[model samples]
Target: MLTLRSFEQRDWPSVWSILEPAFRAGETYAFPPQISEAEAHEAWVEVPAATFVACAPGGAVLGTYFLKPNQPGLGSHVCNCGYVVAPEAQGKGVAYAMCEHSQREAVGRGFRAMQFNLVVSTNERAVRLWKKLGFTVVGTLPRAFRHARLGFVDAFVMYKELIA
Candidate 1:
């Protein structure tokens, strides 16, 4: 079974292990592939309103996610989130659970909506999963992401209203 909880300082190493490959791949997120551990820590943990980890029964972190306001002050009602699952944990519903958990957490925090600023169009699995979870593509930025392997690719700005 998998469990979710607020991230602890001890979780950083495991979280980094999951995030490093994805960020290094440069296929989805826009972060520089060469981003250092301190930079990633600040972005993933320090900057977010909250961060969480998905763990296995043995306490192994299977995935991680962060939640933050998509914008400041006037636009703060809408939140933003990012998720990363260990490569070994992919296709096992970790991302799905994290996304669902994020929505509930967002609503609890009084966010009226949730937005994903940059969903790489080429990441078909994530695009399909987000759609399955009721997020819609609000807009698309053509060639917005310069994928390390695929060159430039379109990116989607996905959003879902948390309130009725």
Candidate 2:
């Protein structure tokens, strides 16, 4: 079982443990592979309107995510989000739960749509998962992502309209 809650200062250690590997590997997010703790906090906590942690019944964090407007001012109705699941907890539906929760939360927060501007093409798991959740690759940006191991790689601009 899992519960979602607002991110707290105490949650950083758990969240960092989940994020560090991904950040160091440079396989997923666009952030620099060597990003510092302070930089990570600025991106994960400070920039987003809300950051959430997914925890087990015992309160151990399984994963975390952040939600924010995809753009500024007039474009603010579109929400954007990023997610990371602990390596040990992968394939157990953490990302799925986070995605579902984000949609409902975004709607409640008055977002009309959700957009993922840079879904790495090689992250087949995430691409498939997001598609399963109703997002479509509205556009592809060729060589937009400088994957650490693969050098420049293609990325997708995925979107899902939540409101009519």
Q: What is the TM-score of each candidate against the true structure?
A: 0.99, 0.98
Global fold similarity of model 2 (TM-score): 0.98
Model 2, span 1-164: residue lDDT tens: 89998999999999988888899899899999899988998999999999999999999999999999999999999999999999888899999999999999999999999999999999999999999999999999999999989999999999999998
Q: What is the C-alpha lDDT of each candidate?
A: 0.97, 0.95
Give the Cα error of residue 123 in candidate 2, in Å: 0.2
Candidate 2 backbone collisions, by pair? none
Off by over 4 Å in 1: none
Residue 97, candidate 2: C-alpha displacement in angstroms: 0.2
lDDT of 2: 0.95
Best by lDDT: 1
